[model samples]
Target chain A: MARHLQDTIYKYVTMCLSGVALALIFIIIGVLIDSSYPALVVYGSKFFTSITWNAELTGSICYTSGIAHMCGATFGVLVYLTGTLLSSGIALLIGAPAAVGLAIVLAEIAPRRLASPISFVMELMAGIPSVIYGFWGILVLVPYLKSTLEVGLSHSLSSVPIFSGAVFSAGLLASGLILALMITPIIASISRDAMRQTPEGLKEAGRALGLTDWEITYKVVLPYARTSIIGSIALGLGRALGETMAVALVCGGASNFLPKTFFYPINTMAAFIVFQLDAAFTDPSGMSISVLAEMALLLMAITMIVNVVARLLVRRGFVSRPENLIQV
Target chain B: MEPDREPTNSVQLQDSFSFEGPVRPRNYTRRKALNLFVKGLLIVAAVLVLYPVVDILYLFAYKGLQVISISRLIETTAGAASFNPHAAGGLANAILGTLFIVGLSSMIAVPLGVFGGVYLAEFSNDNRFSSIVRFFADVLAGVPSIILGYVGFLVLVLRFNLGYSALGAAIVLSVLMFPYTVRATELALKRVPNGIKEGALALGSSKTTIINRLSLKFALPGILTGILLSLSISVGETAPLLYTAGFSDYINWTACCHTQIGYLTYVVFTFYTIPTTNAIDLSYLATFLLILIVLVINIVARVGLRRLSRDLESRI
Candidate 1:
């Protein structure tokens, strides 16, 4: 009877401990919504549309629908939203192709001895802290871009408005490139695993049909791993979107306006929250912090959607076991 | 000479030869060229992808080695307001504080995560509750660290009135570390084959006894890997700890609440922007230390995983 009771108690205890995850998610969402209530009520739908983000620190206090705020303090996330999307989009454009190519090389072209070491190196890259990336970005990439890429682009593509601009040390271009570097290892490793899983019989048939090695890879291997490759890219995209410190350091911290060119300053949603939070604490009306909470809410919702999509696609592909899913 | 008499036979021969001659060589050559070009591109892509990692490491080593020394490891950070190069100090405070905070967080998260994983792998069988927990754990993993920081600041620092304490930072770090541990533990436990359990059951051993004696022992290395990975993550994290932990120049060992703590990541983030040569050098040193620590942890984890898998193979 004692043993029976012990077994039952152990099961219940483990179950309750596991529920911590569920409780955590609920608490996070709950706190965000509860904190952002004032902003949500006041800003309504205009939060997405407006471009102004004045905290109105010096202005007199006012009330909008029972939420008190400094007068003329209008918050809008359009600039941040644009920055997040555009920077991540640029990262995807540059990273996805390079990652696919790297995957192909690792899976099809390189020998096992060579591939394993290179994959290890890439995993190390993934494990490197974000702050280090940001540190490297600020000290190295920003200056390098300013001196070379920006100057070269402006000179060569003078006719194209987006490519032609006064060069800055940090901006959309720097952030995008940094994000690309950050996401490449993630996309490459996952895609390489997926491509490696392609059936040998299919490649053999292609070879028998007089297909070259590259032809076999492109025609047989890539198509077989298509879903997984897409999933990996989406996963990379999710990382790029939420990447904070690196983007924050090199993003130039633009506000109240949208980026005008590739080299123009920008701020992502994730970065903006970090940048604005200290300042948000200054507003006596308490609405500024609430607005920041709303931004967090938006960012969370966006990442959640992307992650869900990525998981579905990955699950539909070769990796059915949950254990096999790569850590992002 | 016989062309006029045999026109139909000649036409048939010409048609058969025509089908084989021109098309095969032209198509084969084009395909071969295309294949070579793509292969070259793939090689280039691989090189490009690898260049940055090497560059970052080289850069850190080049700069960090110049600044790092025994004193740097033993001394505390200088005040943020002090800009004088002469007043610059070492990273002992940050290092110790990181150890304290990450250690505290590990103490809180490891058992919970391990137990949670055990539940998922052993106790539950596709029940609604377990599935819900699993799904939400994935969701929690996906949440941005900055948001976690914001929530941490709001709930722990402000509401709970911990006031930028080590305990607050540890709690936040544990939250960040939790999902990874649970997933890793569950996966490790699941890899334990069921045949052993069945055999033990036939011998009339209780389920709890089998888990405690057999499965836990087998999964120990994997569980350790998970804990190490989480520790590395906690060490590298900056966004979540930014507000919750705040920053300090000296190591405050006794106070868990109402006291700030220094960490390596904060130094890397804040110090470089300062113009002083000493400050920038210290930043590089901090970064180098971070990279070294994370690399060591990852290498240990990888080695552990390999040994565990080999052991499992030999036993099973």
Candidate 2:
């Protein structure tokens, strides 16, 4: 009887407390949506699209009842999000093969001595703070790119797209480069593990078929590990999309319009919000723009969607979809 | 991280050779060519990734050592004007402010996160409660420091009347660090032996007692490593600090929050733009210091974790 009581109490305590944590998600959404009801009701979907982020410079004045002002701001986020995608995409391109190759080396070709150091370095890269990367982007990569390739590339691609000018921090190219560097390790790490976990028998079957090394890898190994690669890429997207400090530092703060040219400076929504919103966050009903909060909601929603998708795809379905791994 | 996909190449190479005589030489040449090509690609990629990082670290260390030698690293930035070659004073104030604020935040974050993790891991399993916690922690983890800056401005700055103070910055840092702590603690707790809990319960120990005594003790090393890692990260964060801590000029000796305190990251971020040699030197020193502090703490964390993992293995 006493034991039963203890078990009952344990169950009760566990049930109540465990639910509390998951409940935080609802709470944050509830509070965010609840608190912003005033703005949401006033703006509706206009919050997502309206442009100019005109914050009343002097005190929280109620006179500025213009939602049209934030059109630039809404467009600013889209531009920055695009920049995020481009940079992370480049990283995926560079890192995907390298990561897979490294995994191959470690699992198959490596002499066991080098694997630990390689893994440690990758973790270190991931662990290093974003601010440090920002510092490096400005001080190191910017100068190097300018000195080595900018002049030549500018002359050659003056008429073409994206690479038409000096490699500076204010454009989509540098911002993308920085974001790419940040996520390479992520994709590489995931792809490496997934590929390594391929069943031994799968490879043996390929061997029996007399397939070449390249064919076996392309046909059998990559196919087996495709879902994990997809998951990693998705996760990488989330990181690139939301990265603030590093992107802010490199992305020149211009929320006026999308970069008509890659060389021209542009501002991402996150960068613009960080740079100006704080200094002007106090006014009446739609007076001093609370677009920062609105932006945060959007970023949060994006993260949630990406994370949910990654997790769902990586469920048991990942294991079951061995044949359709690439589709994942 | 290097992906583990190269095994397929080797597997294919060995498999193809076992087939026959005629195709053997052709398969061998193709694979050898592919191997060479892949090796070349790996070399290029590694260099591309490694260069910028190494160059930045090289510049910081080369420049920073001169200043550190002249005035000493942490002891004094006072006689820094005349004694130090060209730089303005030392990083004393920024270092102090960073340590204090991050220290304060870690104190708050580590406990909240650990308890939250324990609640999820032990009581809730990875169920609705755990999943929700995980989601919030994740969203909170990724919810841009800039957004959290808005939270600090809204809640602490105006609503709580804290304004831009060290305490406010610390509060914001704590919030940002919360998700990491919870994630780390949950990971650490997951590494704990289930048998420990079962054994304690068999002896009639209360669930709370077992959680606090047995599981926590087992996971303490990992938890400590998590806390230190989180603290190191907080110390390096500048965005949330930018919004909450504001900025200060003079070295602040007091623990008061009415006035802002100088931090290395803020100095580095802001001063890097100004076209002054002093500003440039100061920025370099700040970046170097920021990197140094994180490196030391991270090394300590890795060492601690290694030792703890060994200890746990021995106990098992």
Candidate 3:
């Protein structure tokens, strides 16, 4: 009887502990919504549509819908929203193809001797901290882009509107490139695992049809792993969207303005929160912080949607090995 | 064979099957060329993907080595007001503070996470509650760290009135780490074979005894790997800690609440753009240290864990 009772107690205790993980998600969402309510009430639709984001820190206090803010303060996240989407979009565009190609090499072409070392390197890359990536962006990538890529693009593509702007050292282009480098390992590693999971029987069937090695991979393995590859890309996109410090350092900290060109300055929602919170703290009305919370809410929602989609797409009855579930 | 059906098209089937002079397919060369081109592209892609890793390591090592010294490892960071080129202090405070915060958070997160994982793997067995827990843990993992930081600032620092304390930072870090640990533990426990449990049960051992004496032991290395991976993550995190931990120049060992703590990543983030060369150098040094620590943790988790798991499997 005592032994049975002990089992019951242990099970209940573990279940309650598990509940903590579930509770955290709700608590985060609730806290964000509760804090951002003031900004939500005041800004309403303009929050999504307008381009203005002046905190008006020195201006007289006023109330909109009983929420206090500086007289001229307005919060519009269109610029930040655009920055986040465009930068991540750029990262996806560059990273996905390279990642797929690298995955193909790792899954199909590379000898076992070569593959392990490369994988270890990729793991190290994934483990490198975001701030270090940001630091590297500041010291190396930004300057290199400014001197070589931006100059070359502006000169060679002078007639193209997006490509032909006054080039800056840090902006959308650099942020996108940095994010690309950061997320490549993630996408490549996941896609490589998925591609490797393509059944041996399927490859044998392709070979029996006299397909070349490359043909076998492209026709059989890639098709087999299509959903998983897409899922991995979505995962990568989710990561790029939420990347903060690296984008913060290299995105040129644009505010109240949209990016005009590839080289134009921009700011992501995640980066904006980090950059703006200091100034937000100074706003006596406390609405500025609420606006930042709203931005965080938006970021959370976007990433969650992407993650949900990834989960759905990646969960198509494939028996995912535990080791393949590398932390994203 | 000759008359299975009427001849399908203009050309007779017999004539189509007649032996050709060489029997070369028209698109063979094209296919081969396409395959070769793609193979080349794949190789190039692999190289391009790998180049940045090398570049980052080389850059950090070349720059960080110049600034890194024994004194820098032992001294506390100097205040910005005392700005000087030659006399800037080290990151001893940040290092100790990082250890303290990560250690404290680990203490809070590990047992809860492990127990949570056990519930999912051993007890709940795909019930609605466990599924909800699993889904939310995944979603939590995907949530942005900066968003976590904002929430941490709002709830812990402001509402709880922890006031930018180490305890606040540790709580936030533990939250960031909780999902990883839970997932890892669940996966590890699930990997334990059911046959052993059945055998133990047939022998009249209780479920609790089997779990305590058998399964958890087998899954120990995996659980440790998870903890180590999360530890590495928390070590390098800057965003959440920026507000919750709040920076300090000196190490405060006694106060866990309402006192700011220093950390390495903050040094890299804030000091890099400072005008003084010393500040920049310190930043590089911090980056170097962070990279070193993170890499070592990752290697141990990935490589060492694999070997240990293999040894355990062999023994079993």
Candidate 4:
């Protein structure tokens, strides 16, 4: 009787413990759908396509119960959604190659004694909070970009459409710069692991053939770590896509139009929600709150797909070794 | 220099690639120049990685250090004049609020994360349900922190009427922290040698006894590292706490689920936007404190993981 009782208790406890993981999925879906139901019902698919976000219908009633006012016909997230993609895509473009080079330098080129300390510093960089990055972007990066880089670019690249617009201190470019800096550590660390796992035999074989050190690294090591490097870039992409506070602070909070140029101010979906959420709670219109929730749902779906795909890519050949899993 | 030792398989390829006449005395100077160029690029990359860390530290030290004092550490934001960086008030409430929320969250998350990890690692035998659980855990971890805050706003704040409290904020932070804990603990448990578990089983030990008594003890250091990593993540969070914790000017020692609480990230997010020198200084101070907490946590995690690996190496 005692043994049976103990077995039952153990089974119950473990099952319940594992249930927590499953519960998270349900909660995310439930909250998003339940809170955003009114928008789902009212806007249907137009919420994704329409660009206007005029949620300030002074006397309209919200479909969600218990709200006196709400967004009338013109609510949508097309602009913010585009802003999120534009910044993250540009950030990945700028960050991935630099990160790969840094990873190679740390893993193969730098002397062993110097390499470990640099690796530690990169990890420390990763640990800094997103808000702090935003703060730095505002005070330091923005001014520098405005007074130096943007001015230089405007003068040199004025014929280019993207650089023709009047440069703002904070905008898509600023957001992307901050994101590039933020994601460098994640990409570098993961790719370093990939590089470290390359067989020593191949490197030695290259060396024996009178190949230069750089040539051995380029031809033998990099090709071997290609998939892992791609996986790390994907991992970095996921982080950049979902980054909130830092992007929010630097993206200049402009929600009006899709950004036509890199220097034009824009607002990401995450930033829109963060900037508007406080007013959302107190606003007479419940529609704005639900619309934000719907935006959250969209953001959640995207990040989930990116992360899951990235993990699968990272896990494909390294199934037996769990240590290679990307920490992000 | 010895062409005679060339492998038969590579002789034809080498002949085609090399200069036609007597292997043209391998250009030593060109190889040296290429190597130097590559080394220069590597040095540039290293500098690129180090530049931001130095920038943030230098700026914070110059700006944030000037205004920080004992009062700033201990006094509540209440009763202080707004926009005055030199006000007699401090972030004592925000400090306490952060500690309270993070502490309660760790208490809830650590046990649940550990048990879930054990299930994934020790039990389940890679069954379908456990696989699903693991998949969702990964998915949950990838969900943006702001989205989690929105969820918290809907469920805890609006639906449950929890009223922007530390309890609600902690719950949101736990959800954010949960996957890291699970992954870390699971990885740690996997690190325990299979031989040890088999030895225990042969001695007539129950599976529970082996897991709780033997395996957990062995994996404790890695698990602790994971917990600290999660805590650091929780400490640095801003979005989730935005709507869930709200903000209070004063410390509220009321029920955990009732009072709106202040956090350092909140100050960093809100204060710098204000146009006052004092406000900007306060934001910088809060930013410095936040960076300090995360740096310490990350350092501890790294040291703990290194020690755990060393322990594993010794056992081998």
Best by DockQ: 3
Residue-wise C-alpha lDDT for candidate 2, range A1-328, written one tens digit per residue:
6756865676566455434445545655654554455456445576555444444344332322443232222222455555455555655665556556655554544456876666556655666677778877777666655676555677888887766645554556567678777776666666666776789898888877665655677788878878877777776777776677787777766554556555555566556666764445444434234545666667667766886666544433222211111112
lDDT of all predictions: 0.85, 0.64, 0.87, 0.81
The CAPRI category of model 4 is: medium
Q: Give the Cα error of residue B270 in candidate 2, in Å.
A: 1.2
Question: Candidate 1 on B1-316: residue-level lDDT in tens?
Answer: 3221235544766788544332232367778889899899899989998898889889998888988888778889865336775665889999999999999999899999999998998899858998888778877877888989999988998788888889999999999889888877887787778888889989988878988898887777777777887788789999988879988999788446889999999999988877877777889999999999988988888765667766875787
Alpha carbon lDDT of residue A100, candidate 4? Answer: 88
lDDT by residue (B1-316, candidate 4, tens digit) is 5652336436765777754344322565687689789868877966876798889978887776787888888888774446545556678888888988999888889889888888888877778988888888877877888988889988888889898899999889988878778877888888888889999999988788888898988888778887887788799899999989998988875536668998889999988776776666678888888877887887777875667767765875
Which wins on DockQ, candidate 2 or candidate 4? 4
Q: What TM-score does structure 1 among the candidates reach?
A: 0.94
**lDDT ranking, high to low:** 3, 1, 4, 2
Quote the true-contact fraction of every model: 0.67, 0.26, 0.74, 0.57
Instruction: Give the TM-score comparing model 4 with the true structure, all chains together.
Output: 0.92
Across A1-328, the per-residue lDDT of candidate 3 in tens digits comes to: 9999999999999999999987999999999999999988888888999898898888889988777888878789999999999999999999999988988999999999999999888888888999999988988889999999899999999899999979988999999999998889878888888898888999998776667789999899999899888988998999999999999999999989998889999999999999986876799888888999999999999999999898777753442333445545
Q: Which of the two candidates, 2 or 4, achieves a greater lDDT against the reference?
A: 4
lDDT of 1: 0.85
How many clashing residue pairs are found in candidate 2?
22
Return the candidate ranking by DockQ, descending: 3, 1, 4, 2
The C-alpha local distance difference test score for the whole of candidate 4 amounts to 0.81
